[model samples]
Target: MSGSGSQGNGQRLRADCERCAGLCCVALPFTASADFAADKPAGQRCTHLTAENRCSIHAGLRASGFTGCAVFDCYGAGQRVTARPELTPGPEMFAVFRVTRPLHELLWLLTEAEATGHGGAARPLIAEIEALVDGDAAELRGVDVTAWRARVGPVLEEVSERVRRGLGGRDLRHADLVGARLRDGQLRGTTLRGALLIAADLRGADLHRADLLGADLRDADLRGADLADALFLTQPQLNAAHGDGTTTVPGALTRPVHWPSGSSPARHEAPHRARGMPPGKAAPVGGGSGLGGRSGNGRRTGRGGRGRRNDRAGGADGTEGPGRRPG
Candidate 1:
């Protein structure tokens, strides 16, 4: 139910590694799990990171056991932090990144809420957050993100309620439904915020208008599920889950490259145009230029790469999931 005018706003929130200083590669830590090939401690650079701040294995992240890198979306915070030369590659910069990452994510969520036509109540908060994002490193680091979330949470919930007013969906916020069998279920307008749906069977489910803010979807089966209008659903969440050509994601997000190819031609074409890029021109996986004519991490090598995906932090349990790093 998002208006077309604001639908394109989400593009600005995506990660643009070209303008970044490889913050995620160095600022965050990852265990040697299914998503990462090796253990990388916080503040230490990944071995794959190159002199130019690009991932050396850009072309083969998933194949190289760096699937976590492939799907991480910084929501544009990496570039924002990199814009300040004084904060480059330092503890202050990383700390600022930790705070700004969630703020940018809040911006994305509020933008989506506005698109829903019920976000009139969210505009003021959006502007306030935007101003905070534009602040200097000192101001940014001092921000109380927990307090901001406390303020923004209810506004988003109100938007969700208004959007799903008549659907009478279930209230399952913060529920532990890990691996539950809910395939082909009627989940329309459900409030699934912060739900742990890791590896749950949601195949062929109807999730239209469901509130998906902060939901952990690692390994969740979304094949053929309808998320065309899911509330607050993000690219990182989509990247973490298993979907196919039959899966219907929101209009703003692209079908993850790793998803089975050649299934949803119509769905595939819209995201490119939506992101203002021509077909097959999105920023290559794991950004930066090298082998296979692709870029490092999830960035495009040179200036021509347009529309990079964003990233998210880990779930509430403080564990790394697909497309998510530890918070």
Candidate 2:
């Protein structure tokens, strides 16, 4: 409805956050609720926001019942353009995100449509938006909505380099990576709200009680990942990842997925080498010695006692258990 297609000279494209100032926060309307306390109208200023356009109540948003504000992601608008490269001076940065706020909302809807399997209309629209962004990179520093729209297009085509940079990493929010190989990685209780995973390989990872709100599971591999008491991890995330008959996920989460067809669900066990060794040595070279051959341990302990050590370790030799840590 608010301009939705590509035009000539790329004038039909939408605004690009990377090339604009931060807008969504200052322009949008919000009602008082459990998440927000102030009742502000559209295009009005937020009480917590300062004259420099910074949120004065940023630190106390959550404590003051503004949880929703805490989780909102502006599709990398702030970091990509305004905060990045220290784009313009402080005063100029204020207007950047705000000017493009309305356009950002529109673009967000299109992106949602694209993600939900409606790419046909969204694709070209996004392309047009990209072109406009290129033209407005430096011009939008001042306020000229018509000129900006005239130069840009109604829709966006392709992604701006700035926006793309924002989504470079995985959006683990509401994701499920059970038994997934995230060893020694920095997944500190990530917000895996409601993801579906089956037998992932998460070994020796530092998942200090991640939030697993409502994930699905079938057969995941959470070998050594420490989700000790992660928040929100419900039964769904556990069950979808093969959390079974005796499997123990986070203390607060429940197992949703049934075990494999014929086999009984196994219990959550520590890494083999981790049995008697310290937590540091949990991920041994032949970590899951049972899955791969003992030869894999060559790098860890060397070929010192090869044969004798193999038998003494009571190696299963061919059974693929949960200890196989993916790189």
Candidate 3:
């Protein structure tokens, strides 16, 4: 699945909500589910929303049994709207419009979240919303938003078309895809917890502060991508995506496995920090219990070998090491 991002040329294509009254949320509908505390119809007010156009339950939503509100993330849509210079509207209108605007954005995000048969159409529609939100409403008041939305609806239909083709598949858990080439692709803050992808291609794609716990990578390539201050993307994702030999992965992450040009046999899984050594440790010299060491046709080398020897070299069965059998 992919999502659009707030970076690249597309970054300039986002909506400026400050100019307009909240439109999307007021225009949308929702059921009274655990995520939402009340059932609201399209064009209705949310009870928890304040008159000043802010969430009244902002701080206490989770404790108030609105866990859904906690998980909701708008891809900087609110900031973009507020940043517009000429698009200022009154609080009265904002109070009524805030709900719809967020709802519209939510629908748009959902449309792009999955690889549906309508991805192509949905993408441009989302783009249209971005464009509309970016422009001065006074300038666009003459331009029929309803007609534009109607025109863009079919584009959403086409979103499914592109999605069916299976063009992009990338999991960026705490991945460092800064400046990556993710043009017109999807990856809107997809769960990238503890992934490593230094400088990957992600232009015109989505990535709104995705979770990026202890990911590992160094100086890769990230042109035309959207990182936008992703969360938990420690120095490793940065270094790996765009690092040199001097680059170092974060302590939480293990060193990446460097693969040469040609294909090689699959190695063992690297160990986590708890198993006496960190991840990516080499196999024992001869072969013993090792998560990622080589076997049969391969030999441990350099630091990997050293870590392996230090960890598994000790034994009590009278053998020289954990892997080396007694003759």
Candidate 4:
């Protein structure tokens, strides 16, 4: 679950589309698939993008085969990039956005870590990343994101270990368990970081305190699952999976609107306010879920790093692509 007192930083990690300039709609590519109705190349403005920098079809994105748009969280990168006058509506802006997106994601992780009571260890990294994020567009574009991840990934892993300290569950890091049947399993405190869990049957499973960083949950069944306090669980991961009203989530996340209304009694309703949302402001039409970081086959794609599709296709590092849709 989300720790108290991190609400301020959490607000910065969320995408505020009202403040953005349709960067995701213009900078990212989407192939015609079940997730998208048509092919769109990078750097081209989406046809559905309105003159006011909003999605014209925002209200009916999923119904119009643009489910991908509904779940693509920019981690607040879009508004950040748009705020810079030097990088406005050009290749440089998109390039900086590509880099800044992952940096913001790292910020999200660090903030969550601090919220979970690792502030002493997580604060420094958070400060360092914040400095990078606030740098000029040129500096952001030049950042070696791969090297940064290499340094930061271990710290996050350690944080996960600390959070999951006594529960004693399986260490399934990077394990390939796609399509596995694990309904009602006892998985509290399991380390499933980077696990491929696509289409896995996890109904009624206990995942409290389980580490799910970079786990591909697309098409996974989460009905009646206990995910309260699941470490590093993000809105994008929840958006990709199938859950119901009975599926318990962390206090930091809002329930995805796409989830089926269940007959089971609801557990914790966490705050209705979306993370990163401004106080007293309503959530966007689609609830403004996080970005999808998984690929079609359930692999975690890197964001804005070497071998990652910088300013092009695929997801930011450690998450699924922006083009992914509900399963």
lDDT of 1 at 164: 92
RMSD of each: 11.3, 23.0, 21.8, 8.9
Model 2 ranges with Cα > 4 A deviation: 1-22, 78-126, 134-327
- Which candidate number would show the highest TM-score if scored against the true structure? 4
Query: In model 4, what are the clashing residue pairs, if there are any?
Result: 1-229, 11-276, 292-320, 293-319, 293-320, 294-320, 302-317, 303-316, 303-317
Tell me how far the alpha carbon of residue 156 in candidate 4 is from the true structure, in angstroms, after superposition. 0.8
Model 1: runs farther than 4 Å from truth? 1-8, 263-327
Better-scoring candidate (TM-score), 1 or 2: 1
lDDT of 1 by residue, 1-327 (tens): 422224545556777888888887877666564456667666777788878887778778779877667777777778888887676688888778767776776777778778777889779998998898777779888887756766777788788889998998999875766677888999999988666565677888999888777666656778888988887777777876778889888777777877886453222122222235322212222211111111121222111122323232222111112232321
Q: lDDT, candidate 2, residue 121?
A: 60
Candidate 3 TM-score, C-alpha based: 0.30
TM-score of each candidate? 0.77, 0.29, 0.30, 0.80
lDDT, model 2: 0.35
lDDT of each: 0.64, 0.35, 0.33, 0.63
**1-327 per-residue lDDT for model 3 (tens digits):** 222322221322233334323432333344443234454554454565545555556556546644333322223344444445654544423322332333333233334332333344345555655565555555433444334434543443243234323434345433333334444456544544333232333323444434333232222333333444333332213422322223222222222223222333323222321123322322111111111111200122201211222222111111111010001
Better TM-score candidate (1, 3): 1
Each prediction's total of clashing residue pairs, residues at least 3 apart in sequence or on different chains, is: 16, 59, 86, 9
Candidate 3 deviant stretches above 4 angstroms: 1-60, 71-73, 86-131, 139-146, 165-327
| The candidate that achieves the highest lDDT relative to the unseen native structure | 1
Residue-level error in angstroms, candidate 1, position 179? 2.2
